[model samples]
Target: MTELEQDEYTSACEHALTNSMNEIKQRYLKLNTIFLVTLNAATSGKKLMALLLRRLQKIDSEFLSGLSGLVMF
Candidate 1:
């Protein structure tokens, strides 16, 4: 791929990496509120969201590092 394509790929990857984090936060908070109001069990969903958050954090860090390196060139 050309430099331009690489740059675009890096940017897109960066977005994907962070997108999940945001969704995780939104879902977690929403679920928290729902549980507070309705008191339904959310153990499984919370566990899955936590796992997703951790994985996404790793991906986001890697993507940011790569994107920064590409920006340096």
Candidate 2:
């Protein structure tokens, strides 16, 4: 091939490789964002459950205390 043809071929290959790399990077970023959102949702769910459990425990304690007073009569 002529030197000019070979240079053009190399430039085209470089462009193709760069495009492929950018596509891969974008997919990775999208996946990372999805994973972070899922993790945050799970963490928030756990915190809410813990708060509910604490509230339930407090209610149970008060109910038991009131029952004991009734039994003393």
Task: Highest TM-score: give the candidate number.
Answer: 2
Task: Tell me the spans in candidate 2 whose CA falls farther than 4 Å from its real position.
Answer: 44-73
Residue 50 lDDT, candidate 1, scale 0-100: 61
lDDT of candidate 2 over 1-73, digit per residue (tens): 9999999999997896676666556655655565555555666798765655565556556555644554553
Cα shift from native, residue 20, model 2 (Å): 0.4
Task: Give the alpha carbon lDDT tens digit for every residue of 1-73 in model 1.
Answer: 9999999999998897686566556655654554453333334577655665665566556656655654554
Give the distance in Å from residue 26's predicted Cα in candidate 1 to where it truly belongs: 0.6
What value does the lDDT take at residue 53 in candidate 2?
58
Lowest lDDT block of 10, candidate 2: 64-73
> Model 2 lDDT vs. the true structure?
0.62
Local distance difference test, candidate 1 = 0.61
lDDT of each: 0.61, 0.62
Backbone clash count for every predicted candidate, in the order shown = 0, 0
